[model samples]
Target: MDWTVKAGKLSPEKLRSLIFNRLHRRRSDILLRPGLGEDSAVIDFGDEVCVVSTDPITGASCRLGWLAVHVACNDVAANGAEPVGIQAALLLPEGVQDEFIGQLIDDMDAACAQLGIEILGGHTEVTTQVETPLVVITALGRAPRDRYVTSAGAQPGDIIYVTKGVGLEGTAVLASDHRETLLSLGVEEAVLQRAAGFFDRISVVPEALAAAEAGASAMHDITEGGFCGALWEVSAASGWGCEVMVEAVPVLPETKAICAALQLDPLALISSGSLLITAPPQVSIVEAVARVGAKAYPVGRVAAAAEPVLILPSGERRRLTMSVEDELWRFLAGK
Candidate 1:
């Protein structure tokens, strides 16, 4: 069966077993002792707690440094911690120029400076094995030991909220990489520019900070697997189920147009900057998101259901699923 299809997908139990079976041994010294499955990995440090996460930019070779810092820091912030430092590793193909490295570093430095994060260290080199440049960033952040949030903290009655519209990163990447195609199709240059502006939306620092301040109990950035993927992770990690309203999930006009043209499900596309947060029903998460210059909406609620289900606007209910076949795979395979 096609894993992407809503029907005939693997059951959540099978998927969870498949994930845990591959693990070697679990660590015992974890400081912020939350149950399995949380946003950032928490390690207890004296007087404070550290949240660490790492991510990679796979599709775009340009803006490698900028993408690296933002993507990694976004995860750190989602834990309601202030990002403090970053360490990067750059893998570049052979024959790459020194100027390219210099520019990438400059971009990285500028982005870090904007976020008040220091670039502690990194490794950079050129190699023939790599066909293109790839950057991986590991970011570290800290918060008061008493204030950290984890995916497991989400209660069944809490409301599920998302910051920013869906497909921010996907639309930005598509607009930048397919500028000529968009122009040929008679899309306005202004609209394309706005869509390409999603590159700036590649960070969740503001939304994370706002949500954290508003007393969110759990946070997960929507990245490779989009909103559906995020929902699955949060639910599975918390050992709870959720019911998401498909129409209530926010999707931008540009993203809808691009997805329609590409014949892709916007919910399945990659969105690096978007965040999925769970908070008490009393917290005004939507208002908090607006203060940070991002949009937020209540897409669903945590529930006591046995499994994750998505309620379509048409009144049909279907299971939500994820796959190794993400937007990146689909794009490359189609090309």
Candidate 2:
């Protein structure tokens, strides 16, 4: 068989067949192993489950340190656990300044402080293999064995909820990286300013915790593939299906304008901040998110079908599939 490597994540089908199919090593202490939608690995610790997730800041050129902490911590939070600390791996390009490294650490510290996360020991090195700096953070968290949520727990008839909005992280990165392009394209300075500030909304920890306390069946933080891909993941993980209302999914005006300007699909762009959740229809998932100072919308419901579908307001239906490559790559290629 001939194999070709892709730029972003591997295609869902290829990933499962080539990589996930070969996990032969298993330990009794391992509560959870790698899967399509399982964000964090849960390990048995007798009385509690230790949740750990690692992520690297490869997409964003700005806010590398801050994003590293939140992105890794959000994965832990999606498992219904509170992140206690982070181990960061900093790889810097040889010519980077000392002040740049200092600011990066400061940014990481500030973000960790906001979430009460301690910085654990990690390796830092200056290397020439990469032109840009990379920061990878491994987050550690814990919860009761029964309280930890996995992406495979969605049930039929459960309401699907999404917090904040889609393309939040993408919008921030685009605004930061393409401010000049946007300005030349007639986008107002104020709009770019507001879009750049979307970084502040890039953490879903508060809403994930709130949803867990309110009896959420499952939660997956929307990343890489945005909402459509995340919906497919949750469905695949749970062996269920979903009906996502395209109209009900919230989109900010800024996101719409920026995506339109860049010819990107807001729904297919990388979204790291939004949390996709499933809960009983009777449960007030929206209110739970609201209590945490975030907006939530009931975008759809779980169903017994074998695959997920996207429903338009005009009554048209389309099957939702994972993007082989994220829209971010397209945006960058064009730039």
Candidate 3:
């Protein structure tokens, strides 16, 4: 059978069969290898485990460079590593000016400065393969040997918590890219303005380290997938099912307004700023995140159910949507 795929990430099934199962190479020094929801590669570094993750900036156009840096770094941070450096590979479509590149570099530089990291080396070129500028960043981090957490660490009975609000990144993307459409759809300018400022809130490093310090079983940054996707991944990676309380998940008013105007479900949207953290019942981490100036609310728990569970806002118990596509791509595709 001949097959192909549309844009965005591949379904988890394909990832397991076509990708994960086919990797023939193995090494003892590789502490962590690829698996479902395992976003970073961990290599043994004698005293520390080197965590490396790469991410591409594909969805957002307004702050591509900033997203490129932070999103890449977030992957390592989710694994309880502190990112130290990055390398960028930029593929630019022809006709982009030097000023565009300058602005992009400036944005990336500012993000690096904030994180106290540096861009070591990378390649940049104008290519015919892409229609727009595409940035792929590889981030490197380190953690004490035996201290780094993996997606598979969570166990049944652990508490699942989410940091920050759902759909924060998607709200910022829409506010910046579809501002006029949003306004035409009755979204207030003030709402969009507030949402655009969400870019500054996208980094989850502070809370991630705090959760790790509090003995987190697993942590997954809510990226391309929103909170629901993250919850599913963390549970699946750990060989377990989950029960999520829909009403308990935080959704900011700005995000709610944006998603409402776009006729999208905030929970199904891509959210990069939030994180899904799992820990044993005894390890309360809300206070830990709060100490780092972040808010974390318990929204779910690891469960014995074979399939993912959801406690709806209407008080109905149901299965969560297993769709792999983010609402952002699902909505944009129909257009």
User: What local distance difference test score does each model get?
Assistant: 0.80, 0.88, 0.89
Q: Whose lDDT is greatest here? A: 3
TM-score of each: 0.89, 0.96, 0.97
Model 2, range 1-335, lDDT digits (tens) per residue?
Answer: 67566567777778789899988998999988899888789999988889999998888988878888998999999999988999989999999999999999999999999999899889999999879998989999988888889999999999999888998889899899888988887778888899889888889999998998888999999888788878988998999999998999988888888888888888888888899999998778888889889998999999999999999889999988665357887778666
lDDT of 1: 0.80
What's the distance in Å from true for residue 102, model 1?
Answer: 1.5
Question: Candidate 1's residue-wise lDDT over 1-335, tens digit each?
Answer: 44564322234455456664566666764754333345467888867888988777777765778888998998889888899999998999988888998999999998898899899998887888788888989999998887777777778889998877877887888888887777776677887788888888788998888888889988888877688777877887788898999999989888887777677788877788888999989998989888989887898899987667899989899997534235644775667
Rank by TM-score (best first): 3, 2, 1
* Candidate 1, run of 10 with poorest lDDT: 5-14
By lDDT, highest first, what's the ranking? Answer: 3, 2, 1
TM-score of candidate 2 to 2 decimals: 0.96
- Which numbered prediction scores highest in TM-score against the true structure? 3
